[model samples]
Target: MNANDNIKIDDLKKPYFVWFEENWVHDDVLHHHQKGQLVYVESGFQYITIDEKIYLLPQNHAVWIPPNAVHKTNSHSEKIKLMIMFADIRTKNSFYHKINVFSVPPVLKEMIKYAEKWSKQMTPDHDENLFLKALFNELPRFVEHSLTLHISLPKDQRLTKVIEHLHHHYRDEIKMDDLSDTALLSFRTLERIFKKETGLTLSKYQQMLRIIKSLELLSAGHLTISETAYEVGYKSVQAYTRSFLSVMQFRPTDFIKTIQ
Candidate 1:
């Protein structure tokens, strides 16, 4: 499939369909569709932006986008694999109505891979539809286990400058007063506006950014654990590991083992 595939997807008559695309490196522009989408990262990671937040979809994980939700996709690597399922809005499953990133359970993961054989529009009352229905039926339960690897960007110019600075200087010793100076606001005002716009305090937002970037570096296998820690701004490996565990609910070593 090419970049125009999305434009053609809505015209297909199926209630749902699956698309298997490998070696994906393109960055999709802002767009939306009438159907909900569940994108599973079959191999490498990808990032998707929606509602002022950027979500990291790592291997063995999936991100769900509700119908007509404006979003875009990006992948830095050319070796990434993606299996996407687009379902009609009429399914009326409330669980399909939100955007979230979650670990794809083994059963559903296999089911999606198995669906690659029918990688095109699927008709209703057909055997494939039954299988597709079963696959989607399993989504809601897994959503409860969604990951917190998304960073909320801010719309306010002051907060945006602060966020951009943090993105570039996250490894440095950052002070709230410095951030306030960057934003041209008082510390209290900066904190208040930052939290109001991004739903996260300044420090928490930077921490989330570090973790998200660390996942990219670690998953690429280009950096050692200690290197990744320091690269993401932790002064020591222990602190980085603790933060990784706190956010990911698993040690960095364990995570490394999985991607290995």
Candidate 2:
């Protein structure tokens, strides 16, 4: 489950103070942004809608949303996050793509927080601008999914059956015995294989899948919070929000607005 995607910004050109807020039980409509955005999830979970594609990103990861892409967003719970909006696209850029999530070094985090704070200060000092420029120029080119979970299941063809089942039935409650029967493997073996291939336990992976699908539905503006939660196999909207916050660290509403 996720929160709404509605971002309210102060000014892109001016420096600003952004607070991470929390809200549960929300569903957002399809929307896009007019400026480039840099987002970091500090505490909870969030889903980003990119051109109708859903990306499930958890804590300590970031996603770049470009201008003019209609999308929706949700969260399992309210989360803490940082959002930086840019007005111009510089020629000297590192990553060619928009969305990115990787393990951030301590220096980078400090730099981002500092820049954001300094920007909001809005001093007329050339030294400050120069320092900001240097920081941006020196920002590292990081690989995405550097620490992301990657799980690979058993090679048994029957495992394919299990995967197929999950792909279609993520909306429904999942039981180990049911999954085991479908995969034609013992529960014990399937458990091991599931972790081996996916890098997440069965329930954990299911949550990830739900997060992935939530972004899709959010981008399409097709469902309500209650609907989204139930559709994504969540038993309660509050439960969904809690999960979302664990991944995105912000309420779905704020996330949607920022993306929008």
Candidate 3:
């Protein structure tokens, strides 16, 4: 379901804030809103595609999306709890202009949960205003715990095709010559464009994609460590473990333990 299909941001009042929590999967079409948004994932994962770039937002993380930034999302997992809050342009602060993914501190999480609960109740106007004030104060602190996974997507048509192919065939050992042929670009040209557009070499981009996929698989609790390694194209568990550690800063087992 496309959440933006029915909701019209222009119709809503300015300085608006709406909270939502749900456990469902949605593959939304590319869409944008006039107001900035904050999306918090309590559990599960949300893949947000913006301007050809894809952001993998896992549990206990939040992403701040600037106003009118066209994006789409694909939710993974059974219990994809999320909180979405929107703010008008006039009310947006300096931090709202860029995309930021950060660890959801305990205080901020509690505040959002409280706001959700309070909104459901018929609270007095004064009490609601107090909650809003608190929320505003807490939002600025989010940047302090930011995560550095802001991946960029290629704009070139040929590079875009290469990325798409990699997404589909990440489990296989794809050579640069194959990618060059698929993209219809000379090897050097393809390499230059890939690095310039994404700030990552083709091999590094593929590795990051595999690690992100492995995170989802491990979090789901269905795949063993070795199985995940092979599933994501690694020939051995040790190699996969090393790559995963480099990208995610923790072992797959440690990540699984935290989520469990």
Candidate 4:
């Protein structure tokens, strides 16, 4: 049984709930609940959608979903492992009010792993409840290290066409001319409106996508640094390493080691 089994987490009277599962790729329909959610990516990666934007949850990372936030999730990996927690939203902690993706520090990682033993509804004042409370309280200290790599979906049809093309051909050497042709807009108009819609230049946005896809490739351990770089449109390993470091604050080799 898993979190989506007979038990409805939102209907519980307890202050917290925990669930652990390791399975194949899973997808959830769009939904929302009254309790805040914390999902730790034990293996593989997840794509979480909120407010029409997509956030990538890489291995060794966790994502916080605020209460009442409309969202959906999908995982494309062959193996999927995750630890999920839901908490009462009455703690008055502003930190729980927004979506955040963060690297799980060693301390918190162990804490979350330890929590798997009690995968149940936890009531206030219980020993399990106290531990869960402490874990939740410790999250704020790591907020400063959160990642902001969400891909915002554009409202315009032209921009949407361009973004869809980018998603499919990110491994190619994408040029403004190609994008302008895809969007049916002039290069200058496309650049201006793309930035206005997504808050990122077209090239910057594509770079973010490349880095995000690199995380999955690196996690799967099926390719070398150079091959992964090429798979994501980086012609040189140095350029790929620099882009990865700029976004993830670590080199590809270091990332592989950390997650291992």
**TM-scores of the models, in the order given:** 0.89, 0.46, 0.83, 0.90
- Stretches > 4 Å off in candidate 1: 1-7, 25-27, 121-125, 257-260
Which tens-of-lDDT digit does each residue in 50-121 have in candidate 1?
876899887777889999998887555558888888887666667778788887777777788888887764
Candidate 2 vs 4: which has more TM-score: 4
Ranking by lDDT: 4, 1, 3, 2
Relative to the unseen true structure, what is the C-alpha lDDT of residue 243 in candidate 4, on a scale of 0 to 100? Answer: 94
Q: Write the per-residue lDDT of candidate 3 for residues 70-154, one digit (tens) a residue.
A: 8888556777887776666555467777888776777788877776754323223566666766676568775675656646877
Which digits, one per residue and each the tens of the lDDT, describe model 2 over residues 1-260? 12453344424343222333333333556765555455555545566555645565555556655555555664443434544424334544545235454545566666666655443343344555565555544444544234232223345465688877776887788786778887778898888888776566777777767766765455344577678777788889899888766655655554444333
RMSD of each: 2.4, 12.0, 3.2, 2.4
* lDDT score of residue 169 within candidate 2: 84
Error of 1 at 79 (Å): 2.4
- Best-fitting candidate, scored by TM-score: 4
TM-score-sorted candidate list, best first: 4, 1, 3, 2
| Total backbone collisions for each predicted model | 0, 52, 0, 0
Give the clashing residue pairs of candidate 4, or none: none
Highest lDDT, which number? 4
Better model by lDDT, 2 or 4?
4
Q: Give the least accurate 10-residue stretch of model 1, judged by summed lDDT.
A: 1-10
